[model samples]
Target: MINYLYQEQNWKTQLSDLITDPKELLQQLELSTDQLLSGAILASEQFKLRVPRAFVAKMNVGDALDPLLLQVLPHHLELEDHPEFVTDPLGEKEANQLPGVLHKYQSRFLLTLTGACAVHCRYCFRRHFPYQENLPKNNDWDNIRDYIEQNPQINEIILSGGDPLTLTNAKLELWIKRLESVPQVKFLRIHTRVPIVTPSRIDDEFITLLKNCRLQCIVVVHSNHAKELDPYTIDQLKNLTKHQITVLNQAVFLKGVNDCAEILADLSYRLFEANVMPYYLHVLDKVKGAQHFDLDSAQINQIYTELLAKLPGYLVPKLVREIAGEKNKTPLYGETF
Candidate 1:
């Protein structure tokens, strides 16, 4: 059942107490250096290990190839210099308007709410993101509000970053009220991996905050495999759905984690069971250190085809890739060029 309803350790405490040391993480998992290739430890120097204890609880002890572990564990492969894979693969910097704001699409803007996350996946596209420079000043939020007020085309505000949910309820609600003040803004979307990595994050108070908000709220979460959905996590997700809150799950097609059709099919089935709709099944962004996870369009098409045969169309996520300067995500079906 794996319930995080413990009285002692709250989400914040668990987050602060995350396993940052790669050696400690390996020791906790009963793994040895012999199991990992050289540069695995050195690679983590660039983006230090950050895995929540609860998330690590999901990994199988002594299993070197555990899918969840594979996603977070630093590898020697990350050091490989793939010429195509660069730091800013999606060219997010070009669209960055303010320290924390990015007006990427015509009508939608993304706000980097915070540069903090409970888990740091090794293949994260933003692993090299310049968060320290981009994180806004305490009072700079007013500038963001004013920017929204000035722009009439912007209707949707996507709260992203390391993960928006990492902010406290007071902070989030404060920003939500500010966003609600903008008559032009109609929808508030949040992209996060909190629930999967730290299920206790969706406590009663958090749910109540969303229920009380006036703007149309949508929560998009990240979960690559079915195994991430422990009973407690699914219970929280189902709770959101029951409250009439729209919840969706997004996943990246990692070579070792969930590239297989069988695993992805199981992931879709499990997501539906948890009352979450399958959303974007993203092809890996060509970011440095993550080239090991990339899969071609043809491989993705075959997997999507299998998903169509096994499940209804509604359960299949749109397999898409984000290209630099593209208006929207380029759907993998048609020619990407």
Candidate 2:
């Protein structure tokens, strides 16, 4: 097990001190650099390896195949060019209306607050996103507010990014208060991986901020494996639920990570234990540098079939795929490939 010294540090300290070097990550896990180091170096140069130490501690030492490790560890396979895998997998650029604004679904308006994240998952669809150019400016809030006011149908605002929770509480509060000013925005949703990777980000002050918000708040966290939900992570998630903030989990079906029925079921049970509802079980987006994680239709069908048999309706997450230009997330049932 990794040292608990990181537990003493604040979330900001943990965020600033991510393990960026592939060699260092391998050494930390006690894995040899002979076979893995070179490829990792090449792949990381393209996308970069960023993972918090606290999250790294959850990995099985010396076992390079650990699910959590596979998610973040850069590999040579990522360097291979797959014709099917393009950078803009979801076609989010077309939906991007203003700086930091993505108007995909009709009622829900998404905002990419900042381009920073605590852990850089290898399969992230937004890895190739042009965050620097699209990030909203301070003055841009006026335009954002005007846009929301113009569209009275938009009742929800989703705060996404690299991860919205990665921002300081003050920054988050600034955005939240601005969203609250808009009478049309009845719900505030945050799509983040912070609570799972760095639970300390869900600090008391952040919780208080959420509690004080007039709009109903929802936090959709990403956690593919049951191993990701340690005691502290579970407690942090529960803290959100305890404060009347709706907490949900969305997991991607990644090969060598969470492809099996049994593993996905375990994750659902663990999420339920934390009072978090199992949300979407996403099929991997065919983004560049992530073809290695994709599974065939037959493989996906079998695993999801077994998963349906294993869990009750409430515990089973909706198996969905986001197709570019589609009105909604296309639900994959039975043999619908």
- Return the top candidate by lDDT: 2
Lowest lDDT sum, 10 consecutive residues, model 2, at: 1-10
- lDDT of the candidates, in the order given: 0.85, 0.93
Assess candidate 1 and give its lDDT. Answer: 0.85
The residue pairs found clashing in candidate 1 are none
Report model 1's TM-score to 2 decimal places.
0.95
How many residue pairs clash in model 1?
A: 0
Model 2, range 232-282, lDDT digits (tens) per residue? Answer: 889889999998999999999999999999999999999999999999999
Give the alpha carbon lDDT tens digit for every residue of 106-222 in model 1: 888998878998889888888888887897776987899788878888999999988998899888988888888888998989999988988888877888888888888899999
lDDT of 2 at 77: 97
Worst 10 contiguous positions by lDDT, candidate 1: 1-10
Candidate number of the best TM-score: 2
TM-score of each: 0.95, 0.98
Model 1 residue 249 CA deviation in Å: 1.0
List runs of model 1 lying over 4 Å from the truth: 1-8, 35-38, 334-337
Report how far off residue 251 is in candidate 1 (Å). Answer: 0.7
How far in Å is the alpha carbon of 110 misplaced in model 1? 0.8
Which sections of candidate 2 miss by over 4 Å? 1-4
